[model samples]
Structures are given as C-alpha cells and as structure tokens.
Target: MRKIASAFLALLLATLLGTAANPNPGYARVISAGHVEGVLPDGSAYVMDVPTNWNGTVLLYSHGYVPDGASNPARNAPSEAVRTALLDAGYAQIGSAYPETGWVVEGAMPAQLGTLNEFQARFGVARRTIAWGTSMGGMITTGFAERHGRFFDGTIAMCGLEQGSVANWNNALDTLFAIRTLLAPGSTAPLVRLPDQATAIASAAELTAALDVAQTSPQGRARIALAAALRNTPAWTNPAQPEPDANDHDTAQRNQFGALRQFLQTGLTWRQEAEAHASGNMSWNTGVDYARMLANSAIRKQVEAHYRQSGLSLRDDLAALAAAPRITADPAAVAYMIRNISFTGGLTTPMMSIHTTGDPQVPVQTEQAYAEAVTDAGRSRLLRQAYVHRAGHCTFTAGEMLAAVRTLEHRISTGQWPDTGPLTLNRLAEEWDPAATHDYVTYSPGPYPRPFHLHR
Candidate 1:
C-alpha cells in the first residue's frame, strides 16, 4: 500500500480553486469557506485555513509518505472533518505539499520550515505555533520539534515512525528475510535493493502465496506465527473491524496473516526508499539471532500457544532461520540514511505522540524506542505518548485528533502535562463526535525489535 495521507478533497478542490502567484515567488488561492491555498515555485504546495474567529495560533501539519508515482499532493489535514474542527476551534491550519515524497525527510525538513516562515511573512507572526504530523509526517514533526524547537511552542504526532528510518527499515527487513527463508525455502525473491517495481512485485507475490498456504494448517500457522513474532508484527491488521479475540486460534492465524500480507504487499518497497536516498541497500541482519529474537518478542506467548496448538516443534523452524545466511548493509548507505533523516532524541519542546497499538505499517514500538531515547536524554518531561487499540496506520478520527491537539496545547500553555490517561483521552475523543469511530484502548507498546542507536 502507498503510505500517503488520506487524500484530501483538496486535490479535487484545487482544480476548481483558482490561485495566483505573488511577488514572494509563491501563489495563493482563496477557496470557499474563506480558506486560502497556494503553491510555491519549488513544486511545494500549501494551504492556510483561517476562520473568521482567528485565535492567533497556527497548527502546521506534516503528512505521511507519498510513493514514487504519486501524481497528487498531500493535504494540510487528513480529512475535511479535521480541517473544519481545527478552524472551528479558532486555530489556523497550514501545510506544505513538499518538493518530493517517499521518505524524503531531507526535503521535507526545509520545506516545512519554509512553510512556517512563508506563513509568518504572509500573515503576521502568530502568538503560538504548534507542529503536527501523521505517519512519516509524524517522524518529520518529531524531527522538527527536536531540530527547530525554538520555532514552535508544542508538537503533536500521530501514527508516526518515531523509531527513525534505519531501525524502521531494518525491522521490515527482518520479517521479509524470515518469510523468504522459512516459508519459501529456496525460492528467489528480491530481499534488498530491488532493481525495479516489477521485480519487487514478483517477489512479494511469491512470498504472499507462500503465506497463504501457510495459513491453512496449524503447523504452517505456527511457523508463520514464529516468523511474525521475530519482528513483533501485530496480529491485528484491519482498522475497519474490531480486534480479533486473543484466544481464537483461527482468528489469531488469520490476523497474523494480515500482517504478513501487508509486509508482502508494501514491506518490500522499503528497498526503493532506502535506495533512493542511500543510492544502495542500507539494511542488514548479519548479527541477528533468530532464537534470541523470538524469545524476546512481545508476541512470544502467542507464538508458544500457536506452536502448541500445531503439535509441531517451533525449535526446528527457529534453527533453520539461525542457520540461514544474513543480509549486510553498505556502510556508506547506512551513514547516508542516518545523516540525512534520523533523529537524535534531542527534544527541547513539549511533544505529544499517538499511535494505534496494532499498527502494521509503523508499529507502536517506534513510540517506545523514541520514549526511551527522550528519557535517556533527560527530556522525559517534554514527551508524552498515547496508543489507540486500532489496527491500521494513521486511522485516527477527527475527534481523537482534536483531543490530542487540545492535550498538547494545554501542556504548552500551562508548563505541565495534563491528565492524558487513556480513560480521560478516550472520553475526550468520544465527546468530539460520535459519528467518527474512535478506538482508544489502554495499550502499552512493547520495545522495538530494532531501535535506532543515537550513537554510531
């Protein structure tokens, strides 16, 4: 699946909305509802929604990844419902289309910064500015809070990959490598630095077919469960539906297969992102210990239960994985990724991050990794994380989003974090709009399987 944000009606609206370039090397369009949208000469687009009741505060949003072939641009907000709510709450909203997409944080960093500067220049400086993002945008927003802390009063990130690109890509590499080695055995599927989209798709098809067959029997299910467990892939995969019952063996296998399918579908594409930036493969598993990793996984109990149900020995599969050859990274490419897009956990502003507990795209463990980093840096007081029990990536409702914004705003203004307990946050989310399905469950994320080390 392409990792772009929920396509805004803005794309369709942009066609109908007329825009003109000004003396500042940028263009602006005034649309219905008194909203102003624009595009910069650098192929970056932006939108600013200022309601009649201006509150002198601006929420600048960073969006998630846009795949290589994406023709349309990302919007300021995920949904009009979110935009309406933000504007109605007396907050101005702004965002950039970004010069390019697909894990291009190098471009995004400056693009977002320039958008804020452009907004300030167009309309006088705001009394307060809050940075916000979703998914990859969440990573960008977190990076913004860390690097440009002085410019924003607060930050909000949702369903973000805070674990940093290196760790995030490497974690996916673990699952893909395991699936190929354990499930397909000797079949040739591209594992790293895919040459092209066709090759990547073919490789994914082979792995996905193997997974489908594996889901049919208890023995195969057990082995498949072991594969997903090695990387802490969640069994929850669908956001449109409720979570599967933990005790149902069939449901467990089915849910886990959903995660594996997601990897096969989009996980292989990481090679493209890394290659784009690093100019070569930067993922590696040379020192990985499959046995130790399984023992340490958050889903260990689930794997054990499935193995018992299968009446098969899990040790055999694990041994095979341990004996299999490992992948290595190009030292130069690794350095490029780290230098270009990684975070240092050096937060100097109040930041709030939210994620779905069972997100398959960007796992909740990313949050854990980031939280630990900030804590280690003695910046724990400036960070807060919340998890919703949902399954898909960036599946937040407008209400849940607004609740998070308010929570961060309170912290930024009061010099202290508010009651952000799951109960309180859920109640606040529920109060936003009953029509929006908000799944805020009390979930504590496990440690990330491969957290990015701040030091070399």
Candidate 2:
C-alpha cells in the first residue's frame, strides 16, 4: 500500500509541474509568432501570440512614444508575468512597433488595423478585441476607440495624455515659460526650436544650469513652486522612494522641483518635435489669466506655502506672469493638431482608464478632463477611470494591471461596472498576485486646467 501511494504522489507532482511548464491542453499555447511588415514606409513590425485553446478574446497593445532618435521596435508587454498569465488564460496578444515613433498616431492607427487584418488572415478573426496602451500609446488607444469603436469591445488607456498633444504640450509650455519668465528673466532662451539640434541641446544645458542655481535660493524655490502649480505638477515624482507624508511641505517642494528639473532637460527637444509635427508652433498661452489659473490650481495651498516660506509676494509673481509676453499658436498648426490628435469622449464601447496620482509626465488631472468630456457627451455610463497612489508614469504592477483587466472584463461581460474603489482594487490586486507591490490609493482627481476644448 505504501509503494502504491508513493507512486501516485509522484505522478500527481509530475502532472502539476507539467501543466506549469507547458500550458494545459485546453489553455494558452503560442499558435504563431513572427514579424510581419506594416504598411508604413519604415514598415510596422508585429508579434502575435495566441493560445491553442483560444478564448475568443484578443488584446491589441499600443506602446508609448519612442523619441525621434530612439530605436523603433520597442517590443513591449504589460508585464512579462502578466503576459504569460494572459496567454495561459487564452488571451491572444498583438503589438506593433510602429515604423517611426515621435507622435505618429496617424500612421499608427492604420498600422494597427493592418496588423489585425494580418492576424485574421494567418490565424482566424477574433470574436472579441480589446485595445490597450500606455503613455502616448494610451492616447493612440483612445483615438482608436473613438474612430474605430465598432472594431473593439473594450479599451484600456494607462497614464495616457487623452487631452491631445496640443493641450499637453501647451500645458508643459506654460510651466517652462513661467519658470523662464520668473527665475531666469534675463536669459533669452528659446522655448521653441532654434536653428539646429546643437542649438536646442545648448539651450537645454543653459536652462538646466539656471534651474540648478535657482534650486539653492528660497525666492527661486518659491517661483518654481508657482510654475509647478500652474501646470498641476505633482508633489511626488519618485516611485522607488517612500511617498512624503501629506504634511511634509519641504519634501513636497523637493518633489515638485525635481519634476521641474526633468522637464527642463527635455523641454527643448519636445518643442522641436512639436514644431516639426505642427509645421510651426501649435502651443499658445496668449489670453491665459495667471491669477485665475493659480486660483484654479489643485496645489494652490502648496504654492501659497512656498511663497510664504520665501517671504515673497505672490501678487508680484502673478503680475509678472500676466505682464510677460505670451506665446501664440499658428492657426494652420492648431488646425493640424485638432484633426490629427484629439478625443471627443464619444466612446461607443466600454472603456477603462488608469492613472497614477503622482505621475509627473502625465498628470492625474487628465482623468478628470476625460471624465468631464465623457459626461458631457452622455457617455459616462460606458466609461470608468481608476487611480493608483504611485508616483511615476506607467508604474503599475502586473497585479494592478491584471485587476484592471478583470474589472473591465467584468463590465464587458455583465454590462455592470464592478466596485473599483481603492480598497476593492487593492483587494483584487492582492488576490491576483500577492507578491506584487500594489499601490492603490483613494484619490480624487482634480480638473485639468487646460484640455482640447476646440472640438467641443
């Protein structure tokens, strides 16, 4: 009897490990995977992984922007572990490393469709498809849902700049413009593109030096805080470090300044690219009311605190901003942006968006802006937005990602939104992957001061 029991136990262990090593017969298995040329000039390349058991569902992934000179193929997955889990669960995954990457959504949308067509030709048509993306990719995903909503059953946009690149770039311009006008008034640094890359790089270096010097003074710190407030820059920037206590004013300022410093390093390059895309300047701040903007800022109290700490007059700073020469967008360029990139919140399918509360690159306020737009369009019922307490762009864990997917799936399958409160999300995340660093927090997003309003 003992010998028979030992043999049975050994057989059971082998069966479990075998299933773990290879997907079960009725589960995920890579049906086909290889690069297929896209329609764009540079030719989009894609990888499609599907399971043999094949749940009828498919996920089309869109990756974030690859800077002008960066490598084109950014082969990405939500998370490696999540990718494997998804595949094992019979979810087919497809992603295309777009031909050329700096804000190329016009070409990306078509490339994605072409890849889908390819998938259908090689494998079979997916009964259900969901679109998902991160950062600029999120913007692309939102655009896809808006334009091609019928093609997808659901969508997930993560830390996306759904307000359109125009509003996004303009908001960043407002912050840097304020910093330059307030802190380095004498420096004639160019905010838009200069004659060449060398000039742009040099300007970036000079701005960095100015910011370094300014960081040492209370008056400079006060001005930096005001600029950060104007742009709604978060008071937290690092995800690896412990989040500052709500009352820690000094740490808050440090975080804000760190974001400002990061923007300074990339501002020139961003402007140069924006110029190329719009055919000229597309960001404008000309009739903006500085005092009103400050009043509306989510971090007004922080600005006030920093001003008080610096013994500086807030009124003077506001006046300086109001009196400073404001930048204006070229009409043609503005029109280009309007048509090429923007979301009307006309969601025809269920959509879920997740954002980090302290993402310096893409502020949480974007969630509010999108929600407002969706509500205005009377499509709020089809949309849900969730927040994470983390302090970095696209910093969600595999567990968080999985929980969000499950939530969206529940909505799609049942036509009823699941409980997505912080506690609920945290619980789901822990249940999905207990070892993951789940950073769910109860966060009420503030209104985005500037959004693409021309469309509405």
Pick by lDDT: which candidate is best? 1
Residue 302 Cα positional deviation in candidate 1, in Å, after optimal superposition: 1.7
Error of 2 at 80 (Å): 1.9
Collision pairs in model 2: 29-51
lDDT tens digits, residue span 85-113, model 1: 87887888889877665667766766676
Off by over 4 Å in 1: 1-25, 31-34, 434-439
TM-score, candidate number 1? 0.90
User: Which residue segments of model 2 deviate by more than 4 Å?
Assistant: 1-42, 74-76, 193-195
Report residue 25 deviation for candidate 1 (angstroms). 6.5
Q: What are the TM-scores, per candidate, against the unseen true structure?
A: 0.90, 0.89
